[model samples]
Target: MGGASNDSSSSTTRCGVFELSIFVAAIVSGTACSICSKTMMELHGVGIDGTMELFTKPIFQTFGMFVGMMFGLIMHWAVLVLKIPFPGYEHTSALDNDQRPGYNTTSTNYGAIQSEKDQLLASQASTASTSNATPVWMYFFLIIPSIFDLGATALCMMGLRYLDVSIYQLLRGSGIIFVALMKQHVLGDRLFFFQWLGVFWNVVSVILVGATAILNSNDDVDLDPNDAFWGVALVMAGAFVQALQFVFEEKVMSMEDAAAPPLLLIGMEGFWGTLLCLVVVYPLAYYFPGEDHGSYEDPFNTYEMFMNSNTIQWSFVIYFFTIFAYNLFAVLVTFMLNSIWHAILDNFRPITVWLTDLMIFYVITETGDFGEPWTKFSVVQLLGMFVLLYGTAIYNAPNAGSLKLEGQWYSFGFNLRGEYEEIELEIHEEELNREWEERQQNFKARRTSSLAERSPHTSIHTQALRGFASPKI
Candidate 1:
């Protein structure tokens, strides 16, 4: 028993570590993908000048996103319909059957009857699930959030085209403030004083970062300052829209009888989102290419351009696969972990993005147009980054201040084993045994009296055999 307990504990610890690692990897992969997308834009000349039209647009990123969503939809259905388990999980039916009420079986063929009843119950549940599922029309509501999600993605991609990876990541981090505020207002969740303070610090850091950008605009960063500000604006807009999308998703999930598993919900959103993007954005990307300037000329025929430029074509393929993988990782993380954990992981992303970008740019080859290194950040910007980090730490920290302390090492949250006393409920064994014996004696006496009063034809020994009375008595 002790060995079994230890093994179980070890298994639980291993699973926890595995999940944490997966979440961290998801964040890193997402940051890496974003950097890759920006590199593609730099290589392809999509974000160079605001007014220039290009014959070839950066619509490949948009198409890649659509394909990723479609992939997600297909994977989810494969798991659900095919009853295949997701990797790392055991194969089991997605529809829970254990909660169904058990049927009583009192005959000699109880096992057969129980088996038949279980099958009937399973069939009934599947039918009810199909019949009572969300109306097809209500799926249109899902399309709304998908549109917002796509808009956010497009905006972020645009921002990446103009901004450095570090600064762009920092700016996107400010979106947490929007999400927090929306959660408080829309979900009726109250923010603690520290959380509110974190919000204030977040806002201040954003302003400082923006100011730093303006001050350093004239430097030989190679990027136009005006375009940098435009990137900032686009990121902020994307963040706000993304926040709205989150709230909208929450509202939809919270609706009565609309409760669905996260996998299915995400799959549906991806399906609708892909359809909407293809219908609205696909044609616009191809036919109404942006106005042309020297490098910014719209490729009215993207297919022709893709086929002609080997570099662009290869970049598109990489972006396609990377974005698809990123989305899958994101959904899997969300499915396995709660949103708060996801948000906390996101808050930790700037550090990872900064470190990753620094290593990639400084250690690896520099492709001139991917913006400046981390060393180019202004002193004010560094301070602002620290302030933001501090605020986030405070916001996420446990409410340890409320814990009562007995000594330097002693608090309500934990106890020192040496000084702590074991708690055991008092049990009077002697009294309990006496009461139980008396109850038994009384019960036997009643049984004796009842047997004498029973029908003359009934056998007392037969009644005892069937547990109607104590046999020894």
Candidate 2:
């Protein structure tokens, strides 16, 4: 018993360490993606006049992200076609059936039953390998979320043009508010009192962050107060749209027979997004009139400038890889750990981006070549960051009123619930046991009924003996 306990403890510690590593990787990659994207937009090029900041093509930026998503689809296809061993692909149906509670695998007929099950599974696998065509309805079903993603990303990119990367990250917390409201109305989920309080604090954080942007607009020569306000509005609107996407995606995933691999879903969305941008969004932007046609997202000019500028080219390349890496790591974190851990780590991403922005401004680029310096530090902005973090923690914390930290030492020394893992294990075991009991009762009833039909004059004791002797598979 003691040896078994020690082994379990060691295994849990290893899992915790692994999850923590993935969490850190997710944060770093996500921050890199954000910073690289901003750098691409702020990069300057030599023109007829002088050195001018030329890249402000939000639509093109969105298109590049969709192109990166195509790689995810390619990966999914490679995995399926190559028969790769990937996480979340484990087939446990036979194992689960064998391990059912009170089921005797040592029976005389157990070997035959197991062999037949294995043969059936192998036949199904062979059939699936020969015909792997995806259903057409899946493509149509995924387009809904893709449209939402396209709109959200385009709006955020447009907003990013006006605001600093740090502010943009912070303002994204507003999506929690929209998600909460939607969950209540659409999903009929009830929020605890603490969660509602967290929402209120999040609202305060958004207000504070927006006020800081407007107040410090005069410090930067290029930033206009009106533009900053519009940027805040645009980001908030993007957050709302993104929340809608999240809710809709959840609904789709929750439906019966609608489950798909995460990477496959992402790839499908990328396909639709790329198609829409090329045929719809780009054309509309090109024909539509704007106040600053050249400076704004003019795709024709963007293509010309992209061909000439190596800096812009390298920036986009880095952005593409970092964004893909971030998404991959984020998905891994969600699968390996839990959504709560993912949310907690995500709240820290804005802080990482902010510190990286400061380092770039003060240490890397002293001449302000990359972008405008974030030299002016506001106390209110710091307060807003803390408020946002606290609110997120409150919302994600398990239970109500108070927070309890419990987990393995390697799980960052804290989890939302004290007995979360143990409780989940116990509940799962109970469910399995109950299911097994029901199946046993049903099987006995069927055997008894068949015996009665076959031999009407058989005694109840003889029927019982016969049922036990010749157990049905």
- Across 424-445, the per-residue lDDT of candidate 1 in tens digits comes to 0111332355458546644543
Best by TM-score: 2
Q: Per-residue lDDT tens digits of candidate 2, residues 1-473?
A: 01111111111111245556777898999899889988887876544333464687789888988888778788877866564544322222221222211111111111223345455644654454333334568778898878988998899998898888888888887887887676666555454445666677789999988988887786767779999999999989988887777656544432323334456667887889999999999988877777335334567577667777899889999988887777667655544433333444556788999888888887898786663355455678889998987787656544222243445462345454534344345435645664686477446434532212211232332222211111100
Q: For each candidate in the order shown, give its overall lDDT on alpha carbons.
A: 0.53, 0.63
Native RMSD of candidate 1 (Å): 14.7
TM-score of 2: 0.73
The CA lDDT at 99 in model 2 is: 22
By how many angstroms RMSD does model 2 differ from the true structure? 12.2
